[model samples]
Target chain A: MENENLIEVNHLTKVFASRGVMSKGQIKAVDDVSFSMPQEKPTILTLAGESGSGKTTIARLILGFIKPTSGKILYQGRDIWKMTKDEWVRYRKEVQAVFQDPYGAFNPLHKVDRVLTIPIRKFKLANSEEEATDLISEALGVVGLKTDEVLGKYPHQLSGGQRQRIMLARAFLLKPKLIVADEPVSMIDASLRASILNVMLDLKSKFSISFLYITHDLSTARYVSDNIIVMYLGSIMEMGPVDKVLVKPLHPYVKLLIDSVPVPDPERRWKNRIELPRIEITSQSLQTRGCKFYPRCSQRMEKCSKERPDLANVEEDRWVACHLYQ
Target chain B: MPDTLLDVRNLIAYYMTPTAPVRAVDNVSFNVTEKEILGIAGESGCGKSTLAYSILRLLKPPGYIRGGEVLFKGSDLLKIEEEELRRIRWKHISYIPQSSMNALNPVMRIEEQIGDAIINHEKISKGELRKRIEDLLVSVGLSPSVAHMYPHELSGGMRQRVVIAMAMALDPELIIADEPTTALDVVVQRGILQLLRDIRSKLKASVIMITHDMAAQAQIVDRLAIMYAGKIVEIGDANDLFNDPLHPYSRALISAIPSISEKKKLKGVPGFPPDLRSPPPGCRFYPRCPHRIPGKCNVDEPRLIEVKNDRLVACHLYR
Candidate 1:
């Protein structure tokens, strides 16, 4: 049978040995996380979490930038790590990534046009110079960037929004099946975020390209993604359809994450103040056998510290990892 | 008014470059009432931070105050001597610079950092200072044991609380926090914003919060000022500004923010902000404004005029 999934992550885990002077234990950066993106339908899957939650580690693992400690990342039924050299090139082409800082992605010495041109030449997408020029203009036009305005400019010469759009244009040139966007708009201005997000929506509908959108901003994630996975301390806290999970969060961690987002409306200010626990930055804190969020969870139980709850399906189209559900 | 704590009048701060003076804070005017959180909201490089630096007289080389009067408690901070200004800095007006969580000395313990701020202004005994440091840390929602740890030992949220503790070490009547919650996580950001609210209510100290996050401004600020191209385009009550913004730019800015509560199509302001060195002849926002008049908005610059009850806007449409 043909695999209907575009990518499948099976029990992904990554451990980083502490090299700092203050801490001296292994840190489970990503702990047995698993998810899949469908190949038939294009969907935007958002990996939502705070820093140190291992959302970026999963993104890097899928991109083949790092090796997982004990897990497998299967792209179209083939194990990525076990793939041949030809398969690796095809995997790299099919999976593209757009990082947070657009300025850092480009070399300052080269013109911005080189970013789009190099991708097409490397992927062998075009034959003649004329075809390459046409491909470059087409990609830029898709992302709403004009050729004359951005072609000859250096990275600093273009505004932040323009440079980010150029990055999107470069990603579009590959015609990839999946794009992993890590905090694409967090570095740009608030007023310009909507336009970039709109371009993402356009690409999804017009080009049928899926996105692995990783962000801590739930507001933008809600605006775009069809599904979301809430991670905390390298473990999956909640996973479901975006509206179902965000509207009525199941896990305590997901609920706290949603509540903490400041609403733009002034009439509905936060009613209650939450006092955070004193976060300890030691390796000992990371070695908890039970729930990692037990220290800060408001709905902690006696059993929570003794046993860790697995991500179990508690409702239709929703999975939550909490002792309350289990 | 008698309650006006900070009165900034036509403040013009520029960066002196080789080509021309970059008008960072251009002809800006506003008033911060006592015991109210005044928010200055704008995108990056719109000169909100420069305005804060100008108020504190903290501008460095290449940054000159061409003309302005920062009248705090009926005295112009601009005309004050350096020695006199130093005296008023921590004891009367304190500042939490942008990314101040990283501003702490890495080697020093948390208590010593708080102690340094206290000892600089007042001569206190070591025993008394230690007691004060613990109290400050507890007030910002940190444990007393955090005082013994270095800056690196603390998380980003804890370090931010430590910075808040230091700012409150002197109990200044006014605190200006520039993007205090910018780099923090959402949960930590909410905690920091709540701490700021607690500071305003418990201490009755006025706050001037400068940030680009409109949602954070809505959560904390009582009065809001929307900045664009180094000018105050609109200033009004936070409720009124969110409900019904007067200026087009303010409306665009308020609408630009994406919210989970409402499912609305997000619209970004089209064009980039004009260069400060040579801004447009008429309005700086005329290029991207959807309601720009053909010949009028591009010809005459509009001054900030009171449009409604306590609502001021600088737009030809308002006129």
Candidate 2:
């Protein structure tokens, strides 16, 4: 059955083996995570959380770099893990990635052109050197880089912003249906980040490409995303429209994350101080049958520590996982 | 007339390699007042970190302080002898590096590390040293029991607090923090910044914070100095700098920050900063300045001058 969704992740869970400590059980990196992207309209959905929040684990799972312990990832209404060889090849071409460290993404020893050319040749996007050159130039031009300036330079020779743009350009060449950008602009400077972010927006609007923008920075996430999924300790805390999720966050964890951001305006400094956990818990320390955020939640109910809260649709378009909301 | 803790005049530092010399910190001048938190804001490669290293006189080989005066407590740090500089370093002027985990000794306990920094300058008994270490740890919002913990055993935030405790051991008059909260998460960053502010008020110490995060800078800094291509392009009070920026680069920088309050168009400066080895002939920011006056900005550089009350700008548009 061909569902009308672009991507559906149902009960996707990934558990890694514990390291070093014998007492520590398996690390539940991602636990029962589920979401779906629509097929009709392209959307920029952000997965936001702090360091140990399993957001990156979801990205890795979607990219097929690691398989889930149990559950299913349906790509275009088909099981991605069970795809045939030819279907997998098509899936690979349709889904692309842009990573956090642009400097480390490419080999310093090779020329910058190799980043775009190899993908083009492998995908057979163009024939002949001249044809490939024209296509590469067009992709670079879309990202506001001239072929003459970037073609022959090494990765070390280009600035961090330029190198990241080159990565975006390479992804653009694939015309991928989805791009999983993990902390894409975190390493770049704030001044140059706007350009790179705008490039992603341009790609989405101009070419109908969906973006899975993963970031720890809430300000940028609010700026670019149409929808947001707040994750913590390998589970969804809240999911809704960007304004509803960020501006007026339902979950306490989401509120804390938004409040923690040091807004640029000095006039509105944080009025209240928040007490933080003395020690951050690792994934191996997740609770068996309670809210993962129960330990650190400011408004923790007695029931929160006893029974795990299911993600319930509290409002028209907003969903939250908290006993208070329930 | 105000109490100036440190005064830097025409400070120029360069990184010399086989190919060419990178003019990292060129003709930078600023004053840090007593008990004030002055922020040095700029993008990467703008020489803010180099300025921090130059102030400490810790520039390694091939990266030399070319010329300038770093006057701390009415003494020219550049002209001071090695013995005198050593006495002043860590005792009078401490530094918190970007990565606190890397700054600390992984194998050493937090209390012992703090003891090593303090006992070198003061003659204290072992018991008194432990007391002092506990007191310092408590002052930075960390529990006194954390004194015996190793760097690896603590979380990233706790390790940073440990670094802060070490920097504050001698109760230094001035602290230079280069991207102190760069790698930490936002929650941890806010806690760290709050700790720094609390320390400054309690100890009445001056701070020269260097970071590219404008939003984070707005939280604690009293004054801000925006650097571009190794030069201090604008300096003003933090509120004034954000509300009424005089330099085009500073305006673009402040505007580039994404705010969650509203969805405003963020305009990134069109081009990258100039290469320090061979910068532009006139204004270093001319290539990327949207309000550049042709022929004038490209041909003649603007000098930093006092314009409105207490604000300084280096721009042809201002003149």
Candidate 3:
């Protein structure tokens, strides 16, 4: 039997039309982005990029919160866009999201228990109130949250780390096959970030649930993700295994990003000044017939300004979008 | 400490509510020498920002400096009058506050806001002011054209750069940047950090970089101070501290940071940072510390004393 794809996003493009009269052009947020998650085993694929690099747009697209301008999202080898009402419900149940801000994600007026109980009730994971309580407690245990500490308390009563764990516990209640996390640990305290990541890794192993982890922090991404996609201005600069790409990058943009990250180790401080564009990267679409990173690429060629290089496979399991690599 | 530009001694700033006083910055002491960058590292609620606010004398109602002194260039800043402080502010000492989005006024243009800060301190002709504002913008890697744009018209990173430019507008002897690049991306963050380094070297000004990100501190900061529950747990040279953290909390904080180049089992400090309202006695980090001694760490609070050459730690293990 052929291997099935759990989630496949093919040539996705999302463009936001300029709403204000001052802005004349549309913003191409996600331009021709494509990737897939395998069905056989649990995998964590990270979409790493800077702000306005379309990481969040891809996450919103995968969650079905917004419609893509063009392309198809395949869930379990079936077209998600063409799914029926019943099928859509199943798809929604299977794929869930965990947002970055834990404080804003929850309702202040409601008790923390409400967040967990409603998902269990909506999915019909438990039959009665008693079963729901047991399910909630079990899910809470998985994310390292004690039942009593979080069950009846308000969001203000608990810390940010606790609130984030509660969100994870709620996701666990749904038993999602794919969890789309968009910078989940960015807002959380650094000391608490690792534990939450450990919880995600624990869930990945125990339940075999895949994760589409999206973040700008490369360290955490490399720590948790198996495969990585380096994005820049709504396009993939490089895509490969996490270890290979991060440890030794091929593309100039990826190399710049890696070098830019200030590692905790002071022994290897950044020595050379990174060449950057004189102007900040605007939200406007790059409509040039050339490489998008040509303005800032330190090793830009004459061909780079004239032609856009497609993401081509350069080595085994590694793809880079640069004329030099080709 | 004779060459120190900003010297904070046992500073105790607190938030007084109807019920009780929250000691946001309790007995915190450090110094920024001339032409030095002192990086204050800590988690949220650790009172890093409170310390900065207290030194700058910008504490609002319900939040006031309770005790301790801030000595800058042989004079006590905390004891100065409001009028004296107003003259000193942005001229001798300036601030780049956290969240540049809210720092810049929505109604004012970039140049006008910078001009307001400049005109308050010194007397200059209108053309000279415009030229100075443009020069400041250009020095911070921003184009002169950006001066005409409003705060909302610029991006988050651009707003942060503008904030940096405004802080350096008066050639202040000292600059306090509180989480300068917290919300910016890594690529943009690097550029901002570089700009700060350039500003420090070119102007020969002291900087107090207060942030929770140790990774960002390692890049440019000369000295590092780790805080927990409003207390400086450890203080030393940046390279020395990152290589060998004496306090258990500091050690846990350094290790908890996930590395991109290296993968290891990150042992996060378990438990939340102590609440300032009703803090536990003894050491603030005792509850979460891995090397906690039951009687010693839970009963008596450790003082930040010199353990090695130019290194100080507030843990019983060193004592």
TM-score of 2: 0.98
- Our tally of clashes for model 3 stands at 0
Model 1 alpha-carbon drift over 4 Å, by segment: A279-281
| Residue range A152-214, candidate 2, lDDT tens digits | 999988988999999999998998999999999999998899999999899989999999999
Question: Comparing candidate 2 with candidate 3, which one achieves the higher DockQ?
Answer: 3
Per-residue lDDT for A13 in model 1?
A: 97
Which regions in candidate 3 have their CA more than 4 angstroms from the true location?
A281-285
- Tens digits of per-residue lDDT, candidate 3, A223-265, equal 9999999998899999999999999999998998898898888
Q: Least accurate stretch of 10 residues (summed lDDT) in model 3 chain A? A: A276-285
How close is every model to the real structure, measured as TM-score?
0.98, 0.98, 0.97
RMSD of each: 1.2, 1.4, 1.6
Scoring each candidate complex against the real one, what DockQ results?
0.83, 0.71, 0.76
The Cα local distance difference test for each model comes to 0.92, 0.89, 0.89
Question: How do these models rank on TM-score, best leading?
Answer: 1, 2, 3
Q: Which candidate is the best by DockQ?
A: 1
Per-residue lDDT for A125-191 in model 1, tens only? 9999999999999999999988998999899998889999999999899998899999999999988
Compare candidates 1 and 3 on lDDT and give the better one: 1
**Evaluated against the true chain A, what TM-score does chain A of model 1 have?**
0.97
Clashes of each: 0, 0, 0
State the interface C-alpha RMSD of candidate 3: 1.3
Q: Which ten residues in a row have the lowest lDDT in candidate 1 chain A?
A: A278-287
